[model samples]
Target: MRDLNVCIIAFSSTSQSVNLYKILKNKKYNVVMIQTPCTISAGCARSIELKEKDLDAVVNEIKQNNLEIKGIYRRVLNDSTRRYYYSEIDI
Candidate 1:
């Protein structure tokens, strides 16, 4: 099966997630605010979703902005089973 080129950034605060979303959007990055996946335990229920290709740039932006993040995760979808598997990414 093919993998979806998506990554999620988990934050400990909702405000931080929204702030990052706005920052990325303003920079013309395709990002979305989504509910933090159950697999990830975070203080905030919200997270930022972006393409895997943009992961490096996003992380750099986060560093530059001094934003706090709980963790980063990459999601893999099984086409045959229609299930999603998540793996934590070490940044």
Candidate 2:
């Protein structure tokens, strides 16, 4: 998949990432824990990555549960250059 896209989320704290990871996994959301991308300034090294199609439900659930998310990013490959399309969720 040359231009594959996926949804990514970062947290300020590892605990927060871990907690949200558990919540999403328990709910049967296809997800994987990954390192926070450098494009975003999340202090924590850990993050959650899931399929792009899961964005709406995952984002809604995160907001509803009051997860302190650093930000959300869409991993996009454009012209063979990888870039992160970000959205600030928790201010």
TM-score versus the correct structure, for each prediction: 0.90, 0.80
- lDDT score of model 2? 0.80
Model 2, position 1, has a per-residue lDDT of: 17
Q: Rate the local accuracy (lDDT) of all candidates.
A: 0.91, 0.80
Candidate 1: C-alpha lDDT: 0.91
Best by TM-score: 1
Error of 2 at 80 (Å): 4.8
Clashes of each: 0, 0
In model 1, what lDDT does residue 40 have?
A: 86
Q: Which candidate has the highest lDDT of all?
A: 1
What's the CA error at residue 90 for candidate 2, in Å? 10
Clashing pairs in 1: none
Model 1 misplaced regions, further than 4 Å? none
